[model samples]
Target: MPKWPDDDVILFDGVCIFCSRWVRFIAKRDTAKRFRFTPIQSDYGARLARTFGIDPNDPDTNAVVHRGEAFLQSDAALTVLSHLPGWSWTRALLAVPKPLRNAVYGLIARNRYRIFGKYDACFVPDADLRARVIE
Candidate 1:
């Protein structure tokens, strides 16, 4: 088995503006730098999505891979938040129940492009943050 990096990776929709903002949000809050980012369109991102049985062409769910385990959708989002300093409070949302949380997430995801719009191509991280991105 491949030994993945110790830092968590968030695989997201590269063209989605909202997703890009979320990535930036995590980057800002991740003072410990525990997370790295890879856009779903990237070669590595596509491979990971395929390995996890997700459709790479129409990748809909955001995923977080930590310690070789993958968390998808709402669980992934919550897990990422829980790791950030002072953001453990977001984990309190776990009490809301999984199905309900996922439903809301799904709704936003389905309309994300329509609501937040999208980029012509995958976003490129700034030079200072380049080290935290995996192509």
Candidate 2:
């Protein structure tokens, strides 16, 4: 039972180009600085993933830990969007149905490496971006 962060924390596949890009997208839109990030390759992120029953070594979904609650897959994406300024409208996707949303998320997650390619190593954010990353 590791203590979750006070702010919203996103756990993503560090080696996935698409996932890293999504993190950058959220960071750019999150002017309020309400979100923090952790790559699943990190120790803390791995523990969190395991707690949620997500395999860290072969993760098929991203996660968002917001206000002590953890959201997985499509729910996690929607949750992150809702917190971003001007991005709350994306929450409308929630009406699409959880199973459908998760199915789509799963498809993307399963093919992410093949479709978007992977980094040889986990992304290492620069000093400026590192401020928002939770080790």
Candidate 3:
């Protein structure tokens, strides 16, 4: 099996506009530099996705790999947010119930392309943000 990094890593859809934008948002707010990123299109990302049981070809949800465990759907989003400064409050959403949270996440994820659009090519981070990307 492929080895994962020691730090938290977010695996996202690089061609999805919404997913790309979310990555930038997290990169900006993560002042502590606690997170790294991987685009699902990359070899490493694909391996990680498969290990977590997420389809790399037609991903319906993003994922977060932290402390050797994978968090999918709403749990993944909240886990990322919880690590951002002042964003720990997002964990409260956990109290709303997982099925409900995942339902909402699934809605957005399934429609993400039609609703937010897609890129003909995978997104490439700007120079400043490139350092945190794990190809």
* Candidate number of the best lDDT: 3
lDDT of each: 0.88, 0.90, 0.91
Model 3: worst 10 consecutive residues (lDDT sum): 1-10
Give one digit per residue, the lDDT tens place, for model 2 in 1-135. Answer: 344544498999999999999999999899988888999999988988898888999999999988888888999999999888888899899999899999989999999999999999999887877899986
C-alpha TM-score for every candidate: 0.93, 0.94, 0.95
Q: On residues 1-135, what C-alpha lDDT tens digit does candidate 3 reach at each position?
A: 344555599999999999999999999999988889999999988988998888999999999988878889999999999989999899898899999999999999999999999999899899978999888
lDDT of 2 at 85: 87
lDDT of 1: 0.88
- Name model 2 segments beyond 4 Å from true: 1-6
**Model 1: CA > 4 A from native:** 1-7
Which ranges of candidate 3 are over 4 A from the true structure?
A: 1-5
Best-fitting candidate, scored by TM-score: 3
Q: What tens digits encode model 1's per-residue C-alpha lDDT throughout 1-135? A: 343454499899999999999999999888888899988899988888887767878877998998888888899999999989998899899999999999999999889999999999998889856799887
In every candidate, how many clashes are there?
0, 0, 0
Q: lDDT, candidate 3, residue 86? A: 95
